[model samples]
Target chain A: MNLPPLVQGFVLHFGEMGSRWGLNRTLGQMYALLYVSPQPLNADEITEKLGISRSNVSMGLRELQAWRLVRLEHHPGDRREYFSAPQDVWAIFRTLAEERQRREIEPTLSMLRDALLETVETDEEKHAQARMGEMQALMEQLTTWFTEMNRLSPETLTRLMAMGSRVAKLLELKDRLRTRSG
Target chain B: MNLPPLVQGFVLHFGEMGSRWGLNRTLGQMYALLYVSPQPLNADEITEKLGISRSNVSMGLRELQAWRLVRLEHHPGDRREYFSAPQDVWAIFRTLAEERQRREIEPTLSMLRDALLETVETDEEKHAQARMGEMQALMEQLTTWFTEMNRLSPETLTRLMAMGSRVAKLLELKDRLRTRSG
Candidate 1:
């Protein structure tokens, strides 16, 4: 494995983080390796670097590509595919959020909406429907919000994440306005 | 089982999303039941509601407590322990993000730091160290960003996620300014 000591350390760290963010430890580690790699890495190279089974590397790469965390690079005169992460951090952020919304949030929202179509037979059912409606609306709003953000430039995402302390006050005021308007 | 149809739907849906969000399917469904419930539920109650084994509820509730996702509640003269999720969406978000950070990110960072302290003995080791440093730095920054976000009100989170369209641009500008200033 061509693992660098310091870089390898970070790669290991990301691998662990992968599980927390809806990925496995190996997936996290693989992305870390790709993220810092200046050159596009083929699956064989990645398998060699991490010293894991080639099949495991293949599965991990598929997951990363699904997350839009890795890109395939086709080099001339070689049938082997090389991979790399987005150099622009903002693009990575957009793709991650977009993919998550599609994969995780959208299906659940659809299910929630389907539940809404059912007839209520009792007070308990009525109450459940009310709560479901609230959550469904919230999901719809959140989904639309992400869709909008997916369209943003990296600069916007950074500024927004660092919106600083005013964020709290802004939220309170926004809620108040939402209440009044409602 | 006081299973309302819509609530049951929510329970089943959450069960499916559980693995995607770190929790397993049963845990997800169990939490969904707790979230919509007006009163605290004992393990038997949860088991009944979801048609699962009482023992499974016991284990699932234990995991929820560890994640800080479920709260322990008691009633006077009640011997059985009760569990429920925070009804406030923001509180739930805080627990999820914070618990994940502690479990996944912190340990990996520690590992990377230790590896970075080692002396490089070969060209390969040197490259590893360089990669580790970059990853460590990225995790640190991302961690800082999440830490800051954790402090925001749920309304702020909703608003921020709603501001998805602007986040990328905000991030891009932040990166440019950072480059200019650095």
Candidate 2:
């Protein structure tokens, strides 16, 4: 409710980014404010800073919790709930990845598995089936990869980012091999 | 219009995934189906298969076309417009990176730049400005990184996917550093 213009702009920007991320305007702004603040924030602080209704902040907090983007906090002397994001960016990233996988990836995968069972009646159907099989396999492998990636030690992930410069040439070389020989 | 159950499931999953990727459900599904299929799809084919109105498919196709995810094809004697995804996974991925930068990142960056100009007087405003400055710098860099990443040839992009296994670890390690030191 009392955010500075700069912070307000930050909130407004995230509000816009929210729709792109399958969230709404206010949701985006609320999370942006939460994420950037150095200290943990309570609902009342959030409501006062954001100038939204108390109920809206409450609902938004619920959604953010579901996304694993926000963690609840308790102060020794205070009865009101406070929330914060993991200070470690990697932890936040992993939580987001896992949440998206659970909320989006796993269910779609199950549906694909079920669809794989439908009987085919025509050559077109069979061809479609074949193509579907390829994508389904791809999705399954991607899921497996995410599972492993999420479980990987933090040090290992850091090494991976450091290796980005090397990967460009390695992949380009592999592409040439597949193109020329295959 | 006919897709194998497995492909159907994955395509539908992608459709669902699409919203998360900044597309609506119908557009997501349409692109998913197109992405995995061997043949180009017509609007009517998409409408009939997805059980959406023809107009919706028409609009979705237009949006996909704008995103560069769909390309028009003229089959010698065929008058109807048909569309297909880029044949290579890397190409499709590149389109995604580039298109999203254009549609979402670039505009937001501009907005942030403008907001950065507003003069600050209070301590809270200064605090907000400091945070906004940090985020804006990181976002500008990220946008730059995506642009540079897209400029890499498809061969380079595929190789980068292989690098995915390493990125998680590197990012995690960075988080540790920031935690102990920052």
- The best candidate by TM-score is 1
Query: Can you give the TM-score per candidate against the true fold?
Result: 0.79, 0.76
Candidate achieving the largest lDDT: 1
Report the C-alpha lDDT of model 2 over B1-182, residue by residue, as the tens digit.
Answer: 45556566666677777777678888888888787666898988888878889999999999989989889998889899999987655465466768866877777778778777888887766666666666566566556555555566655544455555654544555567569997
Worst 10 residues of 2 chain B by lDDT: B154-163
Q: What is the lDDT of residue A93 in candidate 2?
A: 56
Residue A134 CA displacement from its true place in model 2, Å: 3.1
Most DockQ-accurate candidate: 1
Fnat per predicted structure, each in turn: 0.49, 0.35
Worst 10 residues of 1 chain B by lDDT: B166-175
Over 4 Å off in model 1, which ranges?
A167-182, B1-4, B109-142, B149-182
Model 2 agreement with the true structure over A49-113: per-residue lDDT tens digits: 88899999999999988888889989999999999865555676577668867876677667767
